[model samples]
Target: MTQRNSSFPLTRRAALAVLTSALAFGAAPRVALSSSPLDVVATTGMIADAAMRIGGTRANVRALMGPGVDPHSYRQTRSDIVAMTRADLVLWHGLYLEAQMEQFLADLGRKREVVAVADALPEDLLLSHADYAGRHDPHVWMVPTLWAQVLEGIPDLLAAQRPEAAEDFAANWAAHKTELAELDSYGSDVLSRVPEGQRVLLTAHDAFGYFGRAYGFEVIGIQGISTESEAGLNRIGELVDLLVERGIRAVFVESSVSDRNIRALVEGAGARGHEVGIGGELFSDAMGVPGTYEGTYLGMIDHNVTVIAGALGADVDPRGRLGKLATGS
Candidate 1:
């Protein structure tokens, strides 16, 4: 596997300070919420979906990064800053997932009810980042069980802001957890049908480590953990040789990542007489279009499992678990 050297300036103390300040301030005075829905802002769609489900009708949520937006390289625009500053509550996936927005979010934390939801997860459950020392992979949403644990603290976070709706938030959180458990079961059941030898998941970047870990599949990524990392000729050549040698039949492209590196891998393998096909475009750093089933967290994972299993010779429903996924989507 190739590695890239990167550094994040925000430390645990800085993040803790932000959280402390947010708690002290409660809902900042700038946000005038007088009997209106809680104005919530999330950095990624995954967080926004969970917030919406848990907050129910009490919170109006907006995701800063929408469909096909890669959070890794995304920077906050002037409007994003305005939204964050004015929002009653701001939720971001910490652990350096938003590499470019880390400092800005930390700064914003002092003035708003800011929280890093994923940062509270146990260290044992996280996969260490290959490119950044002492940092874990930020793609926990790839696995249902792990993502459930990340949601455990969210109800309380919301409750802290609106004590009157605490019970409602708890109720919603419980229902959402039940749905997540079912999704986890579906993933395990269908993924089990994949032949043991063909259970390798290769994608554009290392966004599926948690998915691979949960399903007992060997995962490969052309680029490092962060899409900002470059894929060099040496790395591409090595992966091509591996594909030809292992008889791996398919490689996947990510919705948010460029397929250039994936295409290069296919071409390289073809030249060596191993015809590799694109398994399917998997939702990696980002999910599908908003308002679509594939845009939701459950749909994202369902689509991935169905596509992976089908492409690797296992029988799977083309319509996916809930039959909500679009045909060929």
Candidate 2:
């Protein structure tokens, strides 16, 4: 596990609490760990970050899939299953985001605490997953507003499993909610500079429906939701034709998916007379490397906003909050 460089406290007492409790309890206190936040198993780093934000000092959040791990195909290892089995609460993005782990999660839900954070988002905000008819998209965390709703769900999930720290979770959740709202406003203001017509966001996969919904861009994806699903020859040709017709110059590659589909689009467009450029890579399913800017949920969106705006000729500032990356920076 990457040492979570969380801004959350890491005092001697907190470290002692993590160390002593973990060792002292061993397998004996697996029951107690479940009742509260001594040990937590989260599917994605984004969800793990949320659990830490709300779980605070009460729990130690562990991500089963770290940076660059494709969640759609990610399967739990034996150790991961052990952690999930022993965890007080297991938080995942849900909405079929974890295609490979869905069955395990269902069985785990029956036995222990499991709450799909993104599952808590209102149905209207999500686009239906193409593979699973009638099910909504699972990548709600891409948009901060939707993310705030997911964060809010953390306390509700903890309320049943870890009643002892309910108040703490509530307070932490409220503060985090405020932060999410602020991030949303900031993104909106910057993204507002992009002209309405130039707001089309073409990317490697259909992961930005929530982003388009939140920020006013017409999001386009080359591939469907599941990276497991291949983009067909006809689909690629169709997108190339669309790109040339639309005169879209730039399309993005996703962090968690291959650029082959996008490269095919570019070639297809070039053959037809349009020259397409690779826009900056976007954090689709996973974040950037740990300790880097663009690693967290907030930084991921910040990077996307800056990159999209710059590539599309938007007037938004290129630099992110911590000077992570901007058009010029």
User: On residues 72-93, what C-alpha lDDT tens digit does candidate 1 reach at each position?
Assistant: 9999999999999999899999
Which residues of candidate 2, in runs, are more than 4 Å off?
A: 1-37, 129-132, 159-164, 326-329
Please give me the total number of clashing residue pairs in predicted model 1. Answer: 0
How far out, in Å, is residue 306 in model 1? Answer: 0.9
Would you list the C-alpha lDDT of every candidate in the order shown?
0.90, 0.80
- Candidate 2: tens digits of C-alpha lDDT, residues 1-329: 24554534566569768778777768547656555445778999888878888888887888888777888889889999999998877888888889889998999999998877776667766687566577777778888877887777677676666777889899998888887887788788778887766788888888888888888888878777767777799989888887888778889988888888888888888888899898888888898876666777778878987788778877665686456663542
Error of 1 at 234 (Å): 0.9
Number of the predicted model whose TM-score against the real structure is largest: 1
Clashing pairs in 1: none
lDDT of 1 at 114: 92
List the candidate 1 regions with Cα displacement exceeding 4 Å.
1-34
TM-score of 1: 0.89
Candidate 1's displacement at residue 295, Å, is: 1.1
TM-score of each: 0.89, 0.83
